[model samples]
Target: MPVMPSSAPSVEKGPTLRNDSFSDRRDSVNKLETGCLSIIVLGASGDLAKKKTFPALFNLYRQGFLQSSGVHIFGYARTKISDDELRARIRGYLVHGKGGPPHTHSEDVSKFLQLIKYVSGSYDAEDRFRLLDKEISKHEISKNIQEGSSQRLFYLALPPLVYPTVCKMIRRFCMNKYNHGGWTRIVVEKPFGKDLESAEKLSTQLGDLFDESQLYRIDHYLGKELVQNLLVLRFANRFFLPLWNRDNIDNIQIVFREDFGTEGRGGYFDEYGIIRDIFQNHLLQVLCLVAMEKPVSLRPEHIRDEKVKVLQSVLPIKSEEVVLGQYEGYRDDPTVPDSSNTPTFATVVLRIDNERWEGVPFILKAGKALNSRKAEIRVQFKDVPGDIFRCKRQGRNEFVIRLQPSEAMYMKLTVKQPGLEMSTILSELDLSYGQRYQGVTIPEAYERLILDTIRGDQQHFVRRDELKAAWEIFTPLLHRIDDGELKPLPYKPGSRGPVEADVLLSKAGYRQTHGYVWISPSL
Candidate 1:
């Protein structure tokens, strides 16, 4: 374990690490004991592995969450780089231009680097299976020689296409060997597939190799402190629980818009578009957490069971209710040149058949090449009907939960302006996290998630059934677009989105909550 430098000043009373302050009390003597974790990151040379994964692990090490003496990391990839090369790659990414923590002088990093051993192998070849097997055996031998047991965490940082092959190889050479006295957990990345059919097939294939419990379906959003706070805010706060349903709430909206387009990753973006690329896993997962019922327990299975139910309850979208948009001409974008592909933007009005959210429209919109960058959820309450303030200009009360540019939550309620025309005015009761809590280190999404995986907590991870249920809700709309039954609306780059997006909400006899909508000012 690396001791943090004593010379570095410590912010002892910093802001809370997580959003929620209230939690169920566990008996001090009976709490579950977490063991030392050994993680093996596949595709260690990849961008995600270096930038996100390594930094996250380093944070964990600095926080003393990981055992310094017992921890081991193996970097497996096709590249024939030396151990020092791998450490340099990680170190460069950590110290990259973001002004992160200083690089400490300690043997911990060197020892960590010594544990990293690379093996050359094809991503999808059976002959490489032997090399993969040898790597695992070597790790086990090294661990036993140093300590005792050999528990392993395998993270697949490759693209979606290689997931199945990697799982099959793990089953043949890794899983069976680690079963008896040790445990094996695998982390899979997103964009599981292009659509429902492919997703199902991929899920089935993965299931054959690993049990559902051993699989950690990664979605970095859930790892965010604010994202995790969604659950605690509703469940832990007594005052908010009564108003968290259809009777008190009006409608919910989730927006995930990026100012820039694919940014040269267009070749990859063209295939999945905005729907599969972001909405399928990231946006929907947020919706589930916001709308899901309180589970019986905080156990992974219980939490996921409730989420699956929420997804299953979502009413399937018909053509009349759904919206699609594609950004015009991918000229400079090499991913889709002269592309007639569907919109880089889309919005859908979904209703759930469940008692809690029957009438409320769960509006979801995600796009690329939009005017501004934002990711937020706004819950709009129904207007106070036929009230004394019926003559007021403001519409309704709303609660906004922002996830990007900052992490915060606030509510918009109508208040009477002093010495006004006996009328009401709207103002915000804001809770800006950065301003409210000075000098808080909100861990990056991957940092929190990697720690969760190390601790064997799957509450933040997605479940197989939840994935299937999500696919079920979107499959119909997916087919409509794929079969040309639904034509995508055209919108210019650097704009909010297609006019059809506005129309989608208009048809519902509603509009997006102002300041909550995706409006980009001239940059």
Candidate 2:
């Protein structure tokens, strides 16, 4: 195990990393958001708040998205720290220019820091939430904003277990008053629940407290650049519209690989394992976008309706086709048990039973302590009808979308070698964002989602029915793993997971492209 990351404590708190960045979801931002906005960070002193939540707010502030005068930030948690102390704690993490390389802007950081005020409070207490409400109301009154026309965004950066009570408190004491031109919204993070029943129950709890429209079940993966691009790449391109079906594409693979182990955060990793931690929410969300039918329109409900259909169409996971592996040294973390059955790696194949995706397997693979760190989607095309040059031996035609560690998309193509004699070799048509876009700054996922919430856009956030459909597909497999009916195979760290996983991939009808790798092109 390696030394714990400073933000490791929050790993279990929530997927602060459930966060990513996004842009171009809509045609444009339209205009600055209306009303005086009070952004409240619940569980303020936690790692998720400091690392993901606070940094995201600061970024939005520096950008023109958050008007400094209208937005007042508040931090609420059980940690009894002074306002200055809380700001100082998170000061080290507030840097500018995320993605590629980072440089801190002290002036922007200090100004953003001043907007934040801390209030110490327990999660389940009504009085505490009321105090929070008082602070927010005070800010609104001081600004001379109308009593009930102030936007209140409560960001729950705490654990899933306390969501019910925290939400209840928000409902009873912290809502925007019954006034025109103002609304209250709550943004909750993922790890929604351990499985289907719990997820449904959590949904019921939150649903009862607030209307579906007022809630944002944020999964940062949806905010990813590539994931957001899937819609435009599919529907807008006439070339792909004819080719993106089971008749043309052979199989699809959405994979996530982490080159490092749990370090000192095994307690959280052990309980959730790789599947719950990555596959259930992240990979599955990506799959929905990759495989779903084009929506009737770009409206939030329309886009999400298609996603739910894809999830509902998914056939149950086959035990014979599933591969689970735990890294050899996973148990070394004092937080993990010696005899743990948790898997650090998982490869499962999902087949959608719809007209477009029938018989086409969607392979989902995720792991920790692997040889690489990347999350990507690979679309493998079927063999060419007439292979005159026998290019199949070299590689299949695959479109690889690299999500991170350099965002790029390239298509593996068979090209004629430059020679007197006729010859064919595999090459790629590449689009590296770094080289192509040059200096465009992509909005971080949390910042974008938060902005969406204030603007009443649910297109990028998960819907209630979508969440239930997602859990339905994985609940059985999760239950089997919990009962020990499905145990993880052991594999060495820094290696591609268990060899059997490759066998599973092959069985799922995905042909591996050997002896060729797509490197993100540099200028």
Candidate 3:
């Protein structure tokens, strides 16, 4: 067990404030820099553990951000499988799933295989947990680190039901013994809980054993580089900051549209409908990153504070302003039963009552089985009221930040025609990732998130208050859906969505921010 260095800052007083006149703060001491650590992933045999989790870790390692020599990995799960079976199961997902890495390089694959070791046990049984703890301790001691000097991380890749059991077992047997000598950090996956109360209870239960800092709430959306660039795009650049308010901007739309229905996994999909499934965890987080007030500092808590404020500011959505859609299943897809309770699509007309966005609506329209797969943010600047260029065929100025297939920033404004004509036409000032940074492989979301956890940066992780705030914003709609008051509009398999979705936007005098139409000139 590696204890916090005596030189480590005192936690009772909180992080020290940094200043020019004062010496460096204590929090800055063990604060992880860009590249210096090894990560141990628990539950490395599960679906997420293999398809997303391992590939992400491997990408970071391949990119040279993770140290190849000192790093270690261990996979813990219930299924009693041999090492070859575990590797084969992981390989199936890696070579075949979306965003999975290639299965090349026998030498490199062997090296990574050497890092992985699996242990099997029933998660609910205490004796199994005791055995697992003993295994971890023996491995750490055998590494030849004096009497202590071991740091461990446990990632909960399991679902919400098993989380409490896992947490309690770790606390009672695994973490308590290592608390004083070494640090143990636990990273939890989201849909933190099904509702606000559940989220709070889980946090409280976890916090009983681990301090707030030790518990990292993962939201993989924040791992994308484009998502992180949002801060830089808004705050760092003075060009667009002035026009970001209600005065110049008409409305902001954050969309996460998908074209495919729930392919199998009906059990998980039906339990968590559209509201709890995507909007609460992913879409809301994106909205917060865009709408949050500038943090006082780059500290994790400080950044989370601003995000919470945005979530809190989001007004309770009325039943009329939102629309839910369910893509009915076909006879071919046997997984989706006729009586399935899951929603395949959803749209929320959210509002923030803060001064900067008092009247402007922030619409979040996301769904599966839509016309196309798109994820982007559109900021429609207020139309020029009495534009001098109106006679010259002008259009609204819009800024778009795209985060899929290609990561890029683009602005649509009317530019003068090049053929010696004075007529104004809309053209795009595009900064596509493909065009600008050639040959640079932008990492997948999971890869970046896994690396960040190893580095101990909580900026991308969700906070407890933020989680509650997100659930609060969606609770009313959830209630409406539960009480049979809210009905989903039926949309076709290949269409954009139901007609009600169009009405939801049209009533507000805005249109759905479709990419192709937003790009093409009006005939």
Candidate 4:
């Protein structure tokens, strides 16, 4: 529908024209099959790689998304392990079926493992990468793929400190340089940087080596089924369009909670805390999707452009409107410092100073070791101006979109009670995946994101400007917490959070839904 500037450089080579339909995009991706494809995972031995990267790739292979004969999977890490050891480490985490044994499909697992090879190397050394290149070349030669005929997809699953060096090594030694007909892409994990300055520095470093089109800065939340459905629900549904703005809505609550603590991972959690870990990246991305204007078209960059506009409209979070908390027994873990003041919980109010949402408040709340494990968006609509039935104070007519613990969308409404006496009760018009799509399997967020990277779709990935805008909103507050200028309130492990969070919401005209319990569709 739209075309990118001819003079502008893209990470993807050739003319930058937008695909008009889903089939068109699929056809474009399918057209890239001139040679073999190499999927190299850089941090193969780590928890993230084993838990997410490898399992996702295996699922793709099992589903026939990756051509069995033309593809090579390489696992490179500092750990000195055999190929069998690497496969064994990741086998348990690969998805089989719910509650099914991990080793159920022995044949499929064997076939997937056959494509995988392991390389032991230092992250910063060029010679080690040269060895890796040799291994990749061996596969290319066997497959009879000439230079520039194959594609290389490098996934950086390592810690942020090693990103620049590892990227440099991949660029210098491991890239597919034959110019016949192929592309090189890199997928980078989140927490891009701790703050704006560091994020910009990292962006600059990567920019020097790769075009913006070639890099995929991923936010796994965008890959969730419900998160992706936000667009379709708002634009396609007639019921939601008119009531989507501040005029008809009261406030929005975006929440994330976990029943489990960091366990022994406090060493990593203590540095970034809840705000950086969840609020800045995951929750903010969700907010953008919920609040952004309808895009010009379904093209990747078109949707991303609207997301950027929404982020740019958001004013910085006021310090007074923010509440930070540390859960009790946090420092008791041996990995946590005795005097550490990092926040395990945070709630902040963000206001968009734009035409559609000027006066509406968007409350973002995230915490670890709280009362329950759930993530959802609650959109409360404004009260009726005049109502004759002044019955009991029923909850407001609100839309609840559950992101996890169950995937569903339900509207809370006041309905007539089934009794002799005239009264009202809160009921729901629900659409839960469990009941509606019983036999269907919902892919994990990582699986979908990885597939998108392979297809070269950027709609669900976070762009560079969007990342910078998100950092700008939270950087000042992050600095205050880091400097000890603002001390976090303490709360018990199983409690909701500091009492101030409730008060903050109440003051901002939000109803708590204290007495209501969410029922999952399966139950």
Q: Pairs clashing in candidate 2?
A: 20-445, 21-444, 21-445
User: What lDDT does each candidate get?
Assistant: 0.73, 0.84, 0.71, 0.84
lDDT of 2 by residue, 15-114 (tens): 0111123474433343344357888999999999989999888877776566536689999999999999999998888853463334447778888889
For candidate 3, the per-residue lDDT at 348 reads 80
Itemize residue pairs with steric clashes in candidate 1. Answer: 1-68, 266-335, 267-335, 325-343, 326-343, 326-344
TM-score of each: 0.87, 0.93, 0.88, 0.93
lDDT per residue for candidate 1 within 87-161, as digits (tens), equals 888876655423344465244455445656666677766677676667667655654532323456888988888
The C-alpha stretches of model 4 lying farther than 4 A from their native spots are 1-34, 95-100, 146-148
Q: Model 4, range 104-136, lDDT digits (tens) per residue? A: 666777888888999999998888899999999
Clashes of each: 6, 3, 6, 3
- Give candidate 3's TM-score: 0.88
- Candidate 1 has its poorest 10 consecutive residues by lDDT at 7-16
- For model 1, the stretches where C-alpha displacement exceeds 4 angstroms are 1-36, 97-115, 124-129, 132-136, 143-148, 176-181, 418-423, 512-523
RMSD of each: 7.0, 7.5, 5.8, 4.0
lDDT of 4 at 411: 93
Ten contiguous residues minimizing lDDT sum, candidate 2: 8-17
